[model samples]
Target: MSKQPASYRPRHAVILAHPNPASFNGLVADAYCDAVRACGHEAIVRDLYALGFDPLLREHERPGTEGFRLSPDVDAELDILRGSDVFILVYPIWFGMPPAMMKGYVDRVLGAGVTSAQVQHRTAETVLRGKRLVGITSSGASKAWLNEQDQMDSLRQLFGRYLLHAFGMKAYEDLHFGETIEGLDQDYVDANLAQVGDRARAICAAIASDRAQGQAVPPAA
Candidate 1:
């Protein structure tokens, strides 16, 4: 267990994109939070739908545009985000992609306060730099079919590679739970959730290892 001294434990921001609180995506987020908490860490679960987070990107807010600044809402979110180490996004996929809300979060939050030139030149000081990203996506379709269409590949390129590179994140992974329907199979759901917990544990372990290594290494003179 993490013993969780104030500001001492690793913080995980679990971004949940499901409108339905009872959704599989929600469950996945829950399992992740539970597992991390069990490990003595903190979990900040943000349900975008419930929070009524605006996903709209204003034209004036674009980095290159004049009078560019983070919105009050975005600032609030960032206040909640600052000091967080890991980010986990849980959403349901439609048409082989995340919904507008999910994309909006990335555009408005993850992609905020940075210039296009910075991204292209890798000059932006990304707040997410050296952090970890875990994406959990649920779909009604089969993984094989999605792969045949190269949808997952495209998503990986967009999320796994581009997003990580743009944000300077140390690592990224997306776990897809497919064939998820209204009436889910209990056994299958349990198994998938177990996997989610396992992943959470692994992340906690990795975070601990990273902290240990950082402490062990001496700063240069």
Candidate 2:
């Protein structure tokens, strides 16, 4: 039997939504996995829908106490996530929010002693710090239209303020490709693809830069 490579280790966890293989979201997810790997960062891609992830916050688990336990499969996912240094989300915005399954994953996985935990009894500070995040999304509407609505900014707030900030993720980035559904022009699609690739490069550069500078980034909104 061949031995495993000692040089291989994953550095990033990419959680993807949208079930259709033919969908643009799927293509973007694939691109991200490739990009991350090319930069020498191991990438763990979680196809939330394909995994049949249960998104419902069980009635008993609503308070997020020890109300629910992960099934064998979910437990496995949580374990993988726990080891990741960079957490990336690649999904399409439906009505300006995360897909149901992705949202549910957060509800189930992020809580006390997991994504975050309280510190000292006096200040109740958080210690689950030191992580990075990036959001990659596709939209059917034009960029101008999305700009008018401030869709991307609004989403940044949702992730930065609610999830990353709360969980102690230090840095955050977002990339969007709008007007996908209007028409699938090869030129247009290629341009967006290039943009995504650029973002991936930026992500790699930022990681190295931040580390080199000894900078701790605050989660962005």
Candidate 3:
């Protein structure tokens, strides 16, 4: 078990994308929050469905336009994302991708003039530099099947590499919980949920390690 720095308690933001509270994805999110709290950190759980997060990006929320504006909901989520040191996304995979609400959350909250900025003669500058990302995805398919289909590869590329990198985040861990609802037995599901707790602890440990190494923590916007 890794210990947090005695001086600082990192804030963790856990975003729950599944609509059903009884779902396995929700259980994972709950487990993560409990583990984060056990690590002596603050945990904020954003339940997208319960909050009624609008999945559609309205015209006003579009980027690179004069009249572009953010809704209060989007602004709030962005603030949470910026303030937290560790970001965890818990969602169920639908058709080899995150559900619509999670995708929309990424689309709206991670928009320009908020999480990133374009620079001349350089790659897009990300305001979310130095933050850590963890993705917890549940799917009905088996891990072997997902690997054979390259679904895990796609997730790693999209979220762990491309998306997080665009946000200037370098540290990431992607955890896949397959055969979650229908195809798996209770014991296997329990094991995956346990893994979620373990991963949460590991995330806290990594943050403490980074701090001990004098890594710069990104400033909140």
Ten residues in sequence with the least summed lDDT for candidate 1:
1-10
- Per-model CA lDDT versus the true structure: 0.87, 0.69, 0.78
Clash number for every model?
1, 0, 0
What TM-score does candidate 2 reach?
0.78
Deviating ranges (above 4 Å) for candidate 2: 1-10, 60-71, 111-128, 210-221
Off by over 4 Å in 3: 1-7, 112-127, 215-221
RMSD value for candidate 3 = 5.5
Error of 2 at 88 (Å): 1.1
> TM-score of predicted model 1?
0.93
TM-score, structure 3 vs. true: 0.85
Residue pairs with colliding backbones in model 1 are 2-40
Write one digit per residue (lDDT tens) for candidate 2, span 1-221: 24324464447777888878677887777777788778877777788888887887654443345754445555566677775667778888888888887788776654423422332222222222577778888877776787789977788898655566666567777888887784598887777777777787677777667554554445687
User: Candidates' TM-scores?
Assistant: 0.93, 0.78, 0.85
**lDDT string, candidate 3, 1-221, tens digits:** 25444676788888899878888888888889999899998998889999998888877777666688888887777766665888888998899888999888777775445423542222544335667888888788888999999989988898667766676675788898777765457787778778888888888888777777775554687
Pairs of residues at least 3 apart in sequence or in different chains that clash in candidate 3: none
